[model samples]
Target: MGFMSGEELVVTLAPVAVYWVYAGIYEALLQHTTVLDRYRLHSRRDEETKNIASRKDVVRGVLLQQAIQVAISVAVLKLEGRGAAAAAGDGRAAQPEPFLVAAARFGVAMLVLDAWQYFMHRLMHSVPCMYRRFHSWHHRVAAPYAYAAQYGHPVDGVLTETLSGAAAYVASGMTPRAAAAFFAFATVKGVDDHCGVAAPWNPIQAAFRNNAAYHDVHHQRGGGRRNFSQPFFVVWDRLLGTHAPYALRQRDGGGLEVRAFKPDPTR
Candidate 1:
């Protein structure tokens, strides 16, 4: 039977490890900034702070979810190992992908993965039962923080983050190397969405149109029901008419203009 090669194991562990270490530190730093607080979408900082989970709870929950995802990833690698063993026995061989083709395929894979995430995320919130049992654990943070990005019930993690990734890899037909890069990209995307700062320098909100502010609005009790997509691209939410009203920053008044999400037929 096939087994996970040492390289495959490293590939799986590296991304998760980097996220835990790097994102953790970044979240901690941003949690206490004062000037940045003015940019917060919701001005109920005092109220939300009261609702934030204790440090211990956040750490325990995030680590537990991370462990579950890692175990699931390891099992998948073993299955792939078995498939490799079968191919070898049948005299089939694998070929390395050309660089340009690999890059193009990886891009397509992200689209598939993103669409999958949008569907599952909407389902988790749309179905009352699923929301109560599986997705609720995530929303426990009414005001989400960075570590909260990966902090969810294992079942929710499987359906959204894990499945979205596997489907993306398959749909994209990414070579093993491209797949590794996808993991890194996905990790950063998750971190950026939850990091809370939405620093002016972040290109994701501009390039992808969904960032911490877009997602933070969803963390609100009412807004969560409206904005059901995650990770990248609000196009799914826009097309479905589930998108929530958002704020447009005013240059002079330091005020926000409330804007509603509308369907874009052109999308």
Candidate 2:
């Protein structure tokens, strides 16, 4: 328990709270943008404004999934003999300052976690049984909103958080405070990916679209066997020869409909 007092705990959590609040606002705006006439996404919940009112639905699902994840994380930390209960009354224990050491750890952990996530994400899709059982729910929401990001089955949610959390834990130099920041940042990023504005200039979104369009295109086409990279770079896909040749193909007048990669059963 690095939380020395109620005030200290508030200070530790304040940034994460603010980040999520901003995500909530950004998610609302982005979801609206996604369903706008420009994107040709049909509105499902509005008639007067020709807009969808999916914000509440998406928020409810995300919150529910996150609540369950938090509960499971608490249980896991308790079982591992860590957390406030373990650290309580242990003045000898060294706790990193939340603002400094923890913040740095968060940054490093995110970078490493992003790379780890990229590869593991591809495995989830490559394994057919696992994809059907554990990953299909995520793909079900083809026309996704921000809240739709977390609208997955329980096992899927657990596996997703566990992988990211384990990556954060393994990433060197992480303090508990930094771990909190990583969790907060990861949550926001997940929600934002579903916010669908195609803002190519936005750094994070740009990286995601260029490197990880497999999952996004999967939503559009029900399946795609290309562009399976994630997070920061498409190096893995490029090396594997599975990278979607979107840019080259587009220049040659081909479209982004990923079904082109499908193998012909009749062949």
Candidate 3:
């Protein structure tokens, strides 16, 4: 995979631009809607205990991770004999042809990442030691907000996100451009999952209604295993019998609640 100057630009700028736009739109929605406000997990109950990290802090954290990743990816590209350069048009190629090719590759990478996230997340939850010791920092945000998505135990973050990216690079043989786009999508999905709004038929919600609900339950319950998947897909959960049933009998007073699955205490 050899990239010219234009491709490199596309690979670099696309993720930042897309995610920034998404964050703005999501925050605006939160400001205006009471329904969206109610969806926030911590609400006033835990507000005093919350640290409420700023958007600048969140961006800084993400950039730190991206810096490390870029260094590693550069090394990998070199070792693989794949060279990357800046793209000509808004970081794309001078011609429209290669851009389309790269776009398809990005689409495939996103699906592959969704699968990888499901596997790794499930493993983290099922493996108790890993979950309690390494993954707990993420769950500490009882009520998650968009920026809260990347708040991870450093080791856990590197292992799950960075290592996964490295593996995807190897497995999919993705170009820098495609990998860049994939990262953008991944970041947006993470933020959206933690955004705390549950609009039915919203594209993100539609992508993972069960997932958002599962995670919400995890927070509301204060301690429990649920939605051990990320990047918004439930195929693996369905396959592995971890998929929580979504339907609930409506109460006489109205409003739906998730039916709890009885856990085998023997485990």
Candidate 4:
């Protein structure tokens, strides 16, 4: 809330930084190993799915938006009356908060973000011009990879990512420390949603409904509609009658093939 000391800034930035590294490792492991290949929703990867330029685009967008979030968070925390400026090495205040404090507030923040993002995503799909001008950049990857989550147009990125997280953090009744936790968890979940694997053993998929397979349907829907929510829970799409049911059927040789059937809106 107050001016971020160097140490506080480090704490705030750690989530974004750590998530990137973890996602990179996971992405490579999934690609190089057969242990989880059975979970590849679409056996065929797109030309741009793992392109270096695409990864750079995603990284650029993520870092720029994260910088904006850091600046905005200072103000948000201040408004919450928790942003107290600390003097360097003054020992007058704690250096930074412990992790549990951040974790305790993460769930509320996640729910707020997911709800806001669900509506925003549907709105983008509904507007033809909005989809063409911005959201379509993300949909280019019919079979998306982990880093592809952030590879979106700048305008869309600001609206969906930055705005979603900021609003959620504020609405969570969270302190600055908790905001950091929210960012970290969000970054990780976002990548996992687009990671292109849906192993039954994956705890993320098991814990929440929005697994990699869940989001893969969103990317590969091949239509401009349905399965719009990201990260966790297919709540909005289910409520809106737009959540399609999908299954992986065994092919003649043995691999799995994704098949999505539109849910009858009238049902």
Off by over 4 Å in 3: 1-6, 31-35, 38-63, 81-107, 209-211, 218-224, 247-267
Per-model TM-score, in order, reads 0.80, 0.64, 0.71, 0.81
Q: Which stretches of candidate 4 lie over 4 Å from their true place?
A: 1-3, 6-11, 44-56, 59-61, 65-71, 78-81, 85-105, 251-255
- Candidate 2, 1-267: lDDT as tens digits: 342433224323543464467566755664455433332222333222322334455466556666666555555444443345324644523444557655667667766765666566677788898788877766666655545656765676666555556655555445444455556656666655655434435576655554223345545553446555544456666666655543212212212222335433332
- Residue 44 miss distance in model 1 (angstroms): 9.7
Please list the Cα RMSD from the true structure of every candidate, rounded to 1 decimal place: 4.3, 6.8, 5.4, 4.1
Could you give candidate 4's per-residue lDDT for residues 1-267 as a string of tens digits?
Answer: 345655457546776686678677877777687766666655544434533345666678667766775665566655544435343343424455456755556767777888989888888888999998988888766677777677777778778877787788777656555566567777788888877777778787789877776676777656458788876778888888888888867654434556788866963
Better of 1 and 3 by TM-score: 1
Q: Is candidate 3 or candidate 4 better by TM-score?
A: 4
Clashing pairs in 2: none
For candidate 1, the 10 contiguous residues with the lowest summed lDDT are 250-259
lDDT of 1 by residue, 115-151 (tens): 8988899889889999999988887776656676787
By lDDT, the candidates rank as 4, 1, 3, 2
Regions of model 1 farther than 4 Å from truth: 1-3, 31-52, 82-96, 248-267
How many clashes show up per model? 1, 0, 11, 4
Tens digit of lDDT per residue, candidate 3, span 1-267?
A: 234345555554665566667766866766665555544434433433653444466567666666665566556655553333323233432333466666666666666776777777767767899988876666666665665667666667777776676666666656665666677777778777766555565776776654455555555453355545566566665666555544433433322334456333333
Number of backbone clashes in candidate 3 = 11
TM-score of 1: 0.80
